[model samples]
Target: MEPFTIYEQQMQRKLTRWGIRLQKEPNLLERASKSIQNRINQVIPDKIHTTITATVKGIVQTTLFGITYMPKTDPLRGVSMADRDAKAEELLSLYKKIAAAEGAGTGAGGILLGLADFPILIGIKLKFLFELAHVYGYSTHDYRERLFILYVFQLAFSSAKKKPELLHTIKNWPAISQTFPPAADVMKQVNWLQLQQEYRDTIDFRKMLQLIPGIGAVVGAWANFGLLEELGVAGMNCYRMRNLQDKAAELADK
Candidate 1:
């Protein structure tokens, strides 16, 4: 099947699985416009970062709720690390393991038996990706779209014969372009710009980039551009509504 076909199929499946069936046009555009206007007054720049963090946290909770091996909170979930070197070393070791395991060739049709282990790694990767992208200058919309595109690339990689490490695949911008075209180019730009800015910092941002695909850099940069106060609210509210409906069914069964 064509890559675009695969993308559409994946999107369709995700939407359906999320119980998002629109019988007709929802008032999305109008709602979004109103949200931007109403919320901006309430969404002070000082509060922007916190709101964004909350929005992202909610999205993580909603999407990977039951995805096998994912985590409920990101690895950086609690506590601040005063020792930059120690924190950097820990992140590096974890990324190295993920890269090495993936590089060793997981093969096609591979599935993780461990669902509980996924959330932290995935969440940390996302958090790092968003921060990196922001330092380089991208919008939240760009970050989201790039993330969706990268997910598609990851799925396609599993279909191919090569046992590619996430770092190796991301490092090769040309190959990424084969999977995601112009999106890959945009990601490279974002990643490179961010790296230059953070080069002297004590943060192990580079290792973080090497963990996930470079697409995250694009997404993060994009997200940093503005306050995404309503980023995950709609989807989250939908997820909650679905959970409630399911509970209602269980009650009926009893």
Candidate 2:
């Protein structure tokens, strides 16, 4: 790895601060929100909850395992990290607009169309992560790399209470990922129920408001835009951390 320039050092400092913030414990309001979300979950029928869990699990499983789509390798492999990140920011901007449009269209259609937004948004988010991986010069062709993408997804959508552990896992991914089994086995290892519950709890209230008659359109557009923005930040930083660590390791060896 090349030596870090003065600008890179400044960026690294900013990233370190962000990492610390990511691992901090949830505040009181966040805890209260989680409690309220749990109560709402209690009132939802077991059957509906089970269905949603199964649906989400299946969507993720298919995305990871299915042959329907494969991410193209990045053409900018030898480019500087700064250059790659600039391209990544452009991609994020494009996807943000796409997500907001999708959100607005579905949100204006009331409950049924609002339901359709779930899978569509998931697809957009996952596709963007695949592209982000490439921009960072990582190959998603490897199942392990793909698994890292999933961890990034979880880190973005997970509740504040769950963020620390996920952040830690991501930080140590280079070592921890080695112990992972084959792709099929790794898929089975996922706790679908927990994954679904945490994700739903985090977004359900705002999404439910997207089902409302009159204001659904505005709510949906705003919510989707914010969600993608959060994911973009998390994904970029996760990759940035990996790249910086690799550079540091290379320098240490020299």
Q: Scored by Cα lDDT, where does model 2 land? A: 0.86
Best by TM-score: 2
Per-candidate alpha-carbon RMSD to the true structure? 21.6, 1.4
Task: Quote the positional error of residue 194 for candidate 2 in Å.
Answer: 1.1
For model 1, residues 169-215, the per-residue Cα lDDT tens digits are 43343344356535324443333222221211211232223334434
Model 2 stretches astray by more than 4 angstroms: 73-75
Distance from true location, Cα of 27 in model 2, Å: 1.0
Which candidate wins on lDDT?
Answer: 2
Query: Mind sharing the TM-score for model 1?
Result: 0.21
TM-score for each of the candidates: 0.21, 0.95
CA lDDT scores, all candidates in order: 0.32, 0.86
TM-score of 2: 0.95
